[model samples]
Target: MTDFDTGIGDLAERLVTATRTGDHDYVADVLAKLAADDPRTRASALLRDLVDTGAGMIRARTREDNDALYTFDVTTEHDEPVHVDIVPPAPRAALRALAASLNRDAVDRDIHAVLATRGTPDEVVTVLVQCLLWTLELRDTRTPAVRLNCF
Candidate 1:
């Protein structure tokens, strides 16, 4: 049997309430609650989305020889395979597009789309963490590690 068959329904409902509040801490807290009540898978997925969606700060920003660069990575307890290309400081329009894409894609698919998209490493990491928290609260999953790579 799956945790989804047990108290997941009530937990999911509460998660909706938390999200509607638009309070990051609330969302994260409720997510943690859900994890405690449910399975570890939910926690994993939640953490992945949080890190991928910037639902929390997951990206890294630094100046290298006066040149700014971004680094990002994705990991899954499900062990989902990813080969992501490094994205630099893209144009404002590009970043906006990425954000729009992430929001739309994350609505149902969670942070999968955001994890797949290329953006500033810092932004990517942050989104993943935020979305992961939301995902766990709204659903249930495992928490994966943050993988970083530079090119």
Candidate 2:
């Protein structure tokens, strides 16, 4: 695999472990590294900007067919409002699989409501990693929309 791919895989693993174990510092460190390594992508840039701001909000909405839409809103240093939406492929299925792999409880609850209610750090990071992985997959596919920053 390419170095970028390897880096992402490693970071994803680390983020999962950290999130599961409630290691917020480790999660933050991993996110910083990811942002530094891939500053151009929306996910990475958003990570960097959010870290810089030290405050942001995430909203989740469930779509049809077990899909999900995650919206991240943050204000930049210039007071510019930025909103990013990350819709992972079959998010409910993906999150269920993730929970299984992590040996966590079944995701029977409404994930959107959980997130909107300021869910646990674990929930937040889990969704963030999913979105990051989706973005990386999109990058690998060289999708025209991703290439054109149309996502």
Candidate 3:
């Protein structure tokens, strides 16, 4: 796999380990890494959109259902009140669904779903989403006590 492809796997593994150890900082660290101006921004933006429209599609287990609302402060010095929302799925759902997409009967269908929502026909993104889903799945393990509905 390419570095970018491999990076997703690495990120997944890190998220897994982080969850196992109850390290809340790992998500922040992953999100904060400035890989590309657009990619990172898009990642955060997609996260916001997910929480807002597709909440429970990739969310933290620690948060309550009402806490699914996420506000991304994208305000810049040149901008004002630039805010965004992120509705994430429970980590478990994201994991199962994402993994399922890889080998499940709904491969093309799942991919189309993402494309409709994420506007990407790129396989790279498909793989990346899998990684992201796996990462969050591991993250959910950190808080086994906080259970919620899984997709």
Off by over 4 Å in 2: 1-6, 41-151
- Cα RMSD, model 2: 16.7
Residue range 1-151, candidate 2, lDDT tens digits:
5324554445554554566567878767654443444222423333322221111111111123334432233344565664433433233333333333223222422233133223234433454555444434433453222211112
Q: Which candidate comes out best when scored by TM-score? A: 3
Q: Give the Å error, residue 83, model 2.
A: 14
TM-scores, each model vs. reference: 0.25, 0.27, 0.32
Itemize residue pairs with steric clashes in candidate 2.
Answer: none
Candidate 2, poorest ten consecutive residues by summed lDDT? 53-62
Tell me the TM-score of model 3.
Answer: 0.32
The lDDT of each candidate is 0.39, 0.37, 0.38
Clashes of each: 37, 0, 13
**How well does candidate 1 match the true structure in TM-score terms?**
0.25
Q: Per-residue lDDT tens digits of candidate 1, residues 16-108? A: 456656666865655444445323355434333333433222222212232322333333345565443333322222333234433343443
lDDT string for model 3 (79-104, tens) is 45433222233232333333333233
Maximum-lDDT candidate: 1
Residue 35 of candidate 1: its Cα lDDT?
40
